[model samples]
Target: MKNESIQPPRFSSALDPIPDYLTHYFERTAGPFLNICDLDDEEVQKIREFELSNDIKWSRFKMWPEFMKSRKAADDLLMRLYEEKFQKSPAHRPVFAVLGDFHEIPCLYANPGSVRIEIADLREDEVTFMYPDHAHLIQFFDHDAPAFGVPLPENYSEERMPCWGKLFTYQDLHEIHVEYGIKKAIERCLNTPGSFVFSYVEAHIWTRDLKFTPIDHEPTGKCKKA
Candidate 1:
């Protein structure tokens, strides 16, 4: 008999064509793509509510209070994410956001200052240069990066992250299925870096049994940020 322990096939995307809006986001945005894995609109909404109810300003991050407050909120779905993953998450880590056009519904965000990174080479400073953090902004505007994350400024304000951009999302699909599209998007994002590969985060709803198929196709590149 053949080996009994062989695993079943990984998820594929032949059936799930990449939605138009999702592709458009990548094409329109200049930066290398950043996929915020395993979050849903309801939870994202709760996080936004948490931001407002607690007065979580851009520069303000007393994690303890935010933690306590989120814990107290009645939204179990939101706390399920926060209590475990985001409990110790510094405000510096950009918060995911939902935005849209007359076209798209749910776009991801990296709160302007939440993503900090080294930019000394990009600038001319004897000391290190960090934007989005030091400048109190994320520099998401007019970006052409293949992919990079800017840390939120230590003194950032919510006002700095402008709402308009080229972000698009697939609100139509169930959240679990969206993972497939995101994985494909990630593959496209890393392709340029050539040898670089990043971990594909398991979706919050992921389980061992109900897996989706991985799409085997190369990116279409139909979406352009301009």
Candidate 2:
């Protein structure tokens, strides 16, 4: 995994070496179980197929300014489809959504009155719909932690390794899903060793937002950004 010549599996233009810090985190924590993703892997195919099946269009945008105009366009279509097509009220709608990109991070959408139709806003870069009850969700958000694909600092603590590369809402951890022993798992990751953690923060949009570019449809020896 330390080969300097080892490129990032043809989906990204990143020539950066896979950091030793990431390797250490992987070794120290239950990194594989944390469910981080590689774009050029089979795990991503599910979301890709979902997008194609739904005819969700893809575009390249990373800035709010760049995405705003089209965000409304996508929003209009998605809102109409969701509200008029599959209209579900807050209680009837899902408690959370599992955004299926290369990574599978969950998110909270419905509240007292409205369900989030803005979800279609991410269709290009992320796809899929996974309905989660309060029983199966947890969230964390540490501003100090690194975002996905960003390198970790030298001398990073193994204790905080599980906190890296994920989003935190800081709400669901306390606000919702008080049962099903989700906190027990969260504590295991933050307190003990070799633990797996999940988050409900929409880390995907906040981390990359309009800046996220889709990787190639299939893994290859060369980069083919979508």
Candidate 3:
């Protein structure tokens, strides 16, 4: 008997008949998403030195500020990139989300509530997608691992490579879908193992206070609350 080829997972596209929603995960008790950069240095330092019984998936990232001046600098870079692509400043700091159901993300809290926002609800111009997370692409942010865009193995096709170190607007994604079909375009960002693992397309929502529905708590058993 012949063995069947296993197909990779399929995700909804922004242009699909039934499109995917962007998911923002957070500690339900925290209320709304808070930008740490907005906090004073003293409070930020406390978080940086926060004690936890056990290490979490992104525990090391808490030390990231040691490599940079501050978290504000990082957000400035993000805003600069956003303005470079959109030619305008965002009204508020973006609320981050993943393109679809991507539970493998290492940065998620131990027990989190998710807010799902429909793609249709967001303006195409206000949403941007970044492959393998934007921080990995920051020139100054030391990845502390292999650089992105490391050549793939001999058998891997070049077309599978994502637009590394860049952001993609909704129209850009649409153009890619037109050329390669939505499945391949989605493949370009999803499950791509490079210097970083568990990679998923990150969506940055430029507009603030868009309506979203809260979902059930997701317990990943990855870490304890710090």
Best by the TM-score measure: 3
Q: What is the TM-score of each candidate against the true structure?
A: 0.19, 0.19, 0.67
Residue 95 lDDT (model 1): 22
The digit string of per-residue lDDT tens for model 2 on 34-57 reads: 222223435445433433343211
Show where candidate 3 strays beyond 4 Å. 1-19, 49-54, 60-71, 140-162, 177-198, 218-226
Candidate 1: C-alpha RMSD to true structure equals 20.2
- Sorted on TM-score, highest at the top, how do the candidates line up? 3, 2, 1
Candidate 3 per-residue lDDT over residues 1-226, each given as its tens digit: 1133222124433345323667776644444456655667786565455523235455433534352353345456677778888788877777777776565442444335666777787787677876545554544344343333223234433365445546787667666644544444455644454323324467888887577766554344644445
Count clashing pairs, candidate 2.
5
- Find the 10 residues in a row with the least total lDDT in model 2: 106-115
Stretches of candidate 1 above 4 Å error? 1-4, 8-184, 190-201, 205-226
List all candidate RMSDs to the true structure: 20.2, 19.3, 9.1
* Local accuracy by lDDT, each model: 0.24, 0.24, 0.56
Q: lDDT, candidate 3, residue 225?
A: 43
